[model samples]
Target chain A: MISFQKFRIYINKCFIALICLFSFVVLLPFLMLIARLVKSGLKYICLDFFTQTSPSPVDAMLANLAGEAIPGGILNGICGSLYMLTIALVLTVPLGILTGIYLYENRGKKFANLIQYLNAVCYGMPSIIIGIVVYVSVVKSFHSYSVLAGGIALSISMLPKIIRTTRETLKLLPAYLKESGLALGGSYTGVILKIIMPAAKGGLLTGILISVSRALGETVPLIVTALGCSMINWNINAPASSMTLLIWDFFNTPNMVSMVWATSAFLFSIIICLNLIAKRIGRQWKFILYHE
Target chain B: MNKNHILELKSVSISYSPGSYALKNISVSIKPNAITSIIGASGSGKSALLRSINRMHELYPNIRMQGEILLGGKNIMEMNPVEVRRRIGLVFQQPNPFPTMNIYQNVLSGYKLNKIYLSKSEKDRIVEECLRNVSLWDEVKNGLNKNPLSLTVGQQQRLCIARTLALQPEFLLMDEPTSTVDMFCTNRIEELIYRLKNNHTILIVTHNLAQASRISDYALYLEKGELIEYDKSNIIFVAPNDKRTEKYITEQVE
Candidate 1:
């Protein structure tokens, strides 16, 4: 009976090892794809890759046929992404933070619970579904897919993340801080804005950074709203391009494979850089404000 | 409504629910320029009674308080809570100086919160005076920019006192201010409270009978939400009063 128990333990160990191996195997292809993309993507990157607009698909195809490389860069896509993200952040951050504070302050109230439930549902909703909704509401109403519509879509997706993070961060602060503030003759709004919010600044900033990174990489929403342009377009009411959209547009074509890889590498680097910078600043901010 | 009384509580009771009372029908008058200590065992409503002075009990949604608390002959319930708190400050059991603020900022936090603007020199003077009153000025004067958390527990408690004093409050309510600190720190804080009573009416809630004997001019002994004795501190300590107060002081029924 003891020997049988030993065999059962040994079998369990083997199953665990097999599961680990299976997970690694599933992850291996993604690792290799990233490696290959980095290698080919670095070869195509140049100063003009950020400074010049992407060529038309036909122009790019003709250039490839003539034994020339793709003639233009992804400046329009980069600019468009930045524009939409800025608009989205402007639209979403204040509203999200205020809602978060409201939820925290009015925690046990029915209205707060309702807002929390709605936020959870919004957070769990698929990116494509948000895209389709935005397409119908904004794109159709405007009679054209525009960057403004794209921004509205990204803002909706980013709001729940910012709101949740802000609420959680504020809640994690000790109750004594608020009590002390109130005891010092501060109005409720004054205490929240001055003491509680300042204490949670690092967490709020980190949340915004994560939200921005997520918005930057989103493609599905833009596809239905902005509808991808090759030329640089600054008008919010006109079609625009973003890095993700460019990658999506190029990846399926036979000759634009290198462009897709290059764009992917660029986008990945930006997102990683943003996250790292945010973490570093957050640490520094806490050290400056709260270090003992 | 005696002129000497800085604060008066008349038949005040606090209940968190319909049927249970945390503090039951307690009435007391606090004299100005003196330290009055509320002494009781744990769960005896000392803290609840102290909180009612500044209306701190109102912050909790579940708490229900009845009757009147008057500050200087005016009913505090009719006044704005924020304004009432400005005149009657509170110090909690724990030494909670704002972790995000430096010592200088923490001291001036009251003024900043109340929007009582001062020129830079006036601000410096208030900080110095308040810190000196707490006897923490010499230790912390050089490190005004340091985080409040960098200070020892004793210094942190003193810093909180200074923060309260910076607002020029008429009455200071302390709920077990020395309960979390060392014996030495407690002695220092007790001394500061003794000195502060010359300018401010101070109400302290303490579990330590010895501390109440050491610092308080008047003693208010409570038992099971009832005011069992209110007398001069020396009398309350040395003489017999209510059997419960005597029993608690003797540690026979603690």
Candidate 2:
């Protein structure tokens, strides 16, 4: 009995210590990276860092930019990112939600299975490959690089992820939620739009935010299709640049390297803001889960 | 053949697939203004029978049902499934008040979905009366804008009942509606079932024999998907004609 107890204790210790060791090992790199990045990345961050663009190779200390800082702000890059995320979100959210609904509502159909297979394939397809497809289809058709082109490409990558996440979330919802909606005389469209949408709002928003952030960082697809531009441009019909391309651009220009750090800082701030907004929305959506 | 029969099932049988029948050949009548209870063990097709009244079986493409279920003398299977569903409201065992909507919006969900336009004040009156009928008005009156999820489990179940009541259905089908709820909510639902008997026909599927006895005028005892005995609640409870019913009651008592 004593040996049995010792054996059991040994097993318990092995399991608990194994988990702790694995987690610590996994966290080590992240801890080192954040520490290094913050220590090095903080020096290049300041008011001018955000305000000024690189007018010259030598004047990239951010003071020059702060000196010129005005309404322009990160205005152009901000506009580009917003336009990209908005277009991607607008197009992808509806299509993603509908695709999810189709997958669940008609899971038995051959067409549904085919679509699901396509969705899975697209999900695993590298972002660069998607960009290649979109480049040939959208940008090549238009014969120019535009925010619209980048959005179209990014949406391809975003669509499958958003759809899969949303469908999985909706699947987690109690089956009775949909049945209750139907029982209350809701139509097919009504059950999805009013009932499922509300119940899955938090998860849906999380999916969108994750997709948006993922799309925001997407460099390879944007590089081939939309490339990058310097000036502030709005009309999606016009050529534009985004933060990811900007990051890639600065990294190659060793003299313009500090601008990359500043940009990283800026991207981090926006993502933090996005996560905060998502959390607030998540709190709002806890209502649906509570009643479930 | 009764003209007043709100819903009738004639030799209705529902099958899971070709060879497997969930509900065997059964025929029953539901009155327009009375409480009818279906009491059976789990998987006895009691819920299946209730679902068939509204043709909700169509939601499951694999399941096939035979025979005819007439809703107000009209064959529901022949009618538009959507239309049939609208007129026959149902509540399930779980409290499923729409999580996205507030109490008022939950109540108005039926009308909103069907695109039945109602004025603001008129909507208020309907909401008030429905909540009051379910004994949830005073508790929720002040928090009309509060999300339905904020309510306790009992309140949420009551909210679902209110959502069903708002449709003004001719018949309401509740499938084990109280099985998942606490006794306080169960009592409230039972009382609502009794009260609703004066306005609309109600069908309930329950495992609680005492509950079925208290609120139901008639009881149908089903076993292994077969309707074995259906009679006045007192007769079914006290002097069950079928051996299965007797066995079930005795087992519950023990």
Candidate 3:
């Protein structure tokens, strides 16, 4: 039997080895999926892939060696997604941040306490539930699944994230900052806007970016609400389809599996680009915060 | 020293919660342009006493108080907290210049508090003049737009002093302003305090008796939340009226 002291050392070593294995296990699925996607999607990338969107398996994909004309462009899906996402962001970011600030700044007030509890509950709720609520409340009234309904649902789901992140980011700010502003005769709003927000700008930006990313990737709400048409609708007043629905619809199709892979790759790349951009912007924001 | 008694506290007593006396009934008159030092051991209510002048005591919760803190012949309790604070500038022990602001912005914080529309030139002039008063003009002149934290501790403390001065307050409350600074900063701030004494009524809280003797015109000793003694700084150092003051001086001297 090993002595306790030696056993402790052995345990430490085993812990480190376990961490390595766990990391690999965690990464395995993603790596495998990405690797498979890259390999499968390589043959699909071409001038036709760029110019044409909905390629029939019998046309562009099946007649791989034989050149054939493809119909449609992801242009509609792109436009619809861009349009709805913009509306969702416009609806969510400002309202979410303002609510977050209210919760944090007015902390300990009965209203603030209520808001805190509600925000917490909202954050924990499943996005699907929000989607269904939006569907029943807004979509049903319109008597059809619409992009506006989808966007409203997306905005609702994004709201809790934005509020949670904004609240946490505001909390991360130094307590002395508000005190300093207060000491200087600054009003409560002035202190939050001019001092606290500026100090926590980096963290707040990161939080907002996370919320945006979460909104961008959401599909369940869009599926149940927008029901996702293939055509691009510029006006948020009208029905719209987005990339997530395209990915979902294509992946399920027996004949259109190739197009699904391409769209999947596109969406995955977009998310990565977004994350990188957010990371880069966050770093810059922090630099400005500390050294402005 | 300036002859006007700019601020006064009459029988000011504060408690953190119910029946927890942080400061006992303490009466003191702050003279204009004179550096008055509040000296005591830690938890002796020196900081609390200083905070009461600018209504900083209300910054916490469940803390109750009874006091008539007068500013320039008016009880500040009758005025708005913002109004009282605007008239009395405070410098903390630590050099806490706003990190998000540039050197120039920190000096103009007081004006920004009013949210008054100021011409860019007027704002710039205030920043330059205030920084100049604290003798931080040259070191930070080339970098007015640069962040405040990039400056040395000595420069930061001076910047804080400059920040305080920008409010155009008649009195200044410094809570151990030199304790966190180095000797160079200490000397620099002491000199600045000396220069400031001709204009603003200054109340400083510190455990450093020598510092009290060095910069303060009036020295006050407090113990167990009670006023032990008050006299001219030199007299307090050489021939203190209280045995406790004498013991404090002896301990510091050793």
lDDT of 1 by residue, B1-254 (tens): 34634688899999989989988998888877888999888898988888878888888989999989887788999999998999999999998898778999999999888888999999899999999999999999999999898899889999999999999888899999999999999989998899888778899998888888899999998888989999999999988578877878888324
lDDT scores of the candidates, listed in order: 0.89, 0.81, 0.81
Q: Order of candidates by lDDT, top first? A: 1, 2, 3
Worst 10 residues of 3 chain B by lDDT: B1-10
Candidate 2: global Cα-lDDT?
0.81
How do all models score by TM-score?
0.94, 0.88, 0.91
Clashing pairs in 3: none
Give the candidates in order of DockQ, highest first. Answer: 1, 2, 3
Worst 10 residues of 1 chain A by lDDT: A283-292
Native-to-model Cα distance after best TM-score fit, residue A162 in candidate 1, in Å: 1.1
TM-score result, candidate 2: 0.88
- The TM-score ranking, best first, is 1, 3, 2
Q: DockQ scores for all the models shown?
A: 0.63, 0.62, 0.61
| Candidate 3 lDDT, A120-198, residue by residue in tens | 8998788889989998998888887777888788889888888888888777666778777877878777887888877
Top of the candidates by DockQ: 1
Which docking category, incorrect, acceptable, medium or high, applies to candidate 1?
medium
DockQ of 3: 0.61
